[model samples]
Target: MSEQGFKYSILASGSSGNCFYLESPEKKILVDAGLSGKKITSLLAEIDRKPEDLDAIFVTHEHKDHIHGVGVLARKYHLDIYANQETWQAMEGHLGKLDLDQKHIFQMGKTKTFGDLDIESFGVSHDAVAPQFYRFMKDNKSFVILTDTGYVSDRMAGIVENADAYLIESNHDIEILRSGAYPWSLKQRILSDLGHLSNEDGAETMIRTLGNRTKKIYLGHLSKENNIKELAHMTMVNQLAQADLAVGHDFKVYDTSPDQATPLTNI
Candidate 1:
């Protein structure tokens, strides 16, 4: 990886809303605009970026938790909104409130190049209108952002296998989610094959697929009500320890806060 290559940051990552910022000196992009426009703006400001500085916005799905501020942000800043046809159609009603000129539909699997960065969207197992995850590469550096998937399929595993870093969902602890205050239906939904990934699942998946290049992981999309940071980390640690993997030595786990921005990392 070139020292001058692209940089990425997790502005805010959790159940309430998820957003990430990726930038090179010349171009900038946002992945998922789940937060409100004002909040997103404030986050961008904290990172020394303006909404107008973004060249495009890529949405992973149509869920409100992923596209809440997409329309407003794109419309207000006149930035391009790139999504698959299905995702765009699913969000058409909400998107119509924004300027039509900003909408750009490109099928998943088609690489979208933004100057120094190459981006590819791939399918993820999530309950939404065409949900997808993203792989980003610049220079010799690359990473895959995989989250909100209920289970990690073989295909998804293949995509994540070659990455240097992974921003994955460690949504909840299995025991916690099963016995928490949530109703049966909600609990069932979360445990379903199309719901979120549990902390144990995340650890096992990482242990099974992690390569030497995969040195850093940001455990994202945690359920604030059902999962606690220490518990989630400890569960993952126990799971990986059985496989002879140590957290800080093998690969570090960074717990993303629901109410704060996570620090930038080098892959």
Candidate 2:
């Protein structure tokens, strides 16, 4: 890693909760804070970070699993919260009372700089009022955090191309999801263009966006009941191989867990 590189960790990611910690030379922020405030604080502690050290929280959507802890963390730490106007309105009722100064809204598709890092939000296909994903750039390096989307449009794929690192969704395996214990309606929701991405779709998105600059790829947002880490990992590896890409030599794949944090990695 270079002196000006970016670093990040998946504090937790899944259907249960989804949060990520990212930092540039002059900034430290959470992409989302989906767990309980206490739990998120504990996870940050494991990485030797303190809540008081954070700059802000950037939300992907208003879903409970994606914004559960946003209000608590903001009130406790006096941190700023960034989201599109639509997402802010949808999540406001559930986030409790927040100080006006703590709320910051960013326009979709526009880049905003917190410090050394420049982040751009783009729309994603999800059930929320206005779901979004982000691309963070610093010192010519890019890191993308894209999850909770049913399908990646070609435009979105182009926006994230050549990222140095990625934490993208690989929610479930098609066969397992089809035969899993979930109700048929629920399965359809997960398979819809407005729902979550299946493992196969996630792999294809990776193959489309991957480039020479890509170094690490973290498969995230797995379903505990319908998918397992090994299955998601193997699915990605096999699909990438079919695209003439090697997992290790070309880029390493990592699995994110709902209960733990991935090692802080440089991008």
Candidate 3:
């Protein structure tokens, strides 16, 4: 409750690319830099910052959309990049070359520090090797970022339930994804246990996971093909509404954009 300074911005989100900008009192960092270095830095400039100002980049998993710009940004800015041991193995070759000193491997479930902030990674079910989600905390307040998982496990829900704010995946609507023009294999992949969250699944997860203290949420990683912003938004809103957890009164939900940066948020 005493957390003073924490900010998060989704520089971009979706299947095409993903990136996040984060700041703590004594450290400036990014969660992922899936965008090109040029695009990432340009987005940074929009917030009146620069790549050289970052202290580190924390990667979630090995997917290209989560790491496309990691190597370039790290090499250009001479910044440290943190990833779990398995993730490092899965993504190292794909990231091109990185200086030895720039690699910082963290143990999953153990806490690591950056100035006033503390970060913890937890396993999440996904197609990639060692895919995961993260919790970032300072003082008693916390923010959580979870994406690219097919379903929300009880354990995963428990881990993130009490966060002050959350950036969670609301990837597609079930009917839309199933009935869309995508091929059968692609549709099955998206609907599988290792695929992505459907809009209804997202709503159910939030109903189970969101605490009374949790106030703000940004629905992210939406699919441009099988989903649209308003559908995802109204889906969750209506679900929560049925649960009597009214939006705006109980909490606020923001739909993240795939093509542009979402508004800066504080936690």
Question: Which is the leading candidate under lDDT?
Answer: 2
Model 2 TM-score?
0.98
TM-score of 3: 0.96
Best of the candidates, TM-score: 2
Candidate 3, residues 53-103: lDDT per residue as tens digits?
999999999898999999999999898989899999999998888889999
lDDT, candidate 3, equals 0.86
Candidate 2, residue 56: Cα displacement in angstroms equals 0.2
lDDT of 2: 0.92
**What alpha-carbon RMSD in Å does predicted model 1 have with respect to the real structure?**
1.9
| lDDT of every model, 2 decimals | 0.82, 0.92, 0.86
TM-score-based ranking: 2, 3, 1
- lDDT-best of 2 and 3: 2
- Give candidates' CA RMSD values in order: 1.9, 1.1, 1.7
lDDT of 1 by residue, 115-216 (tens): 778787888888988888888887767778888889998877876684677787889988888888999999988899999999988887887777877677
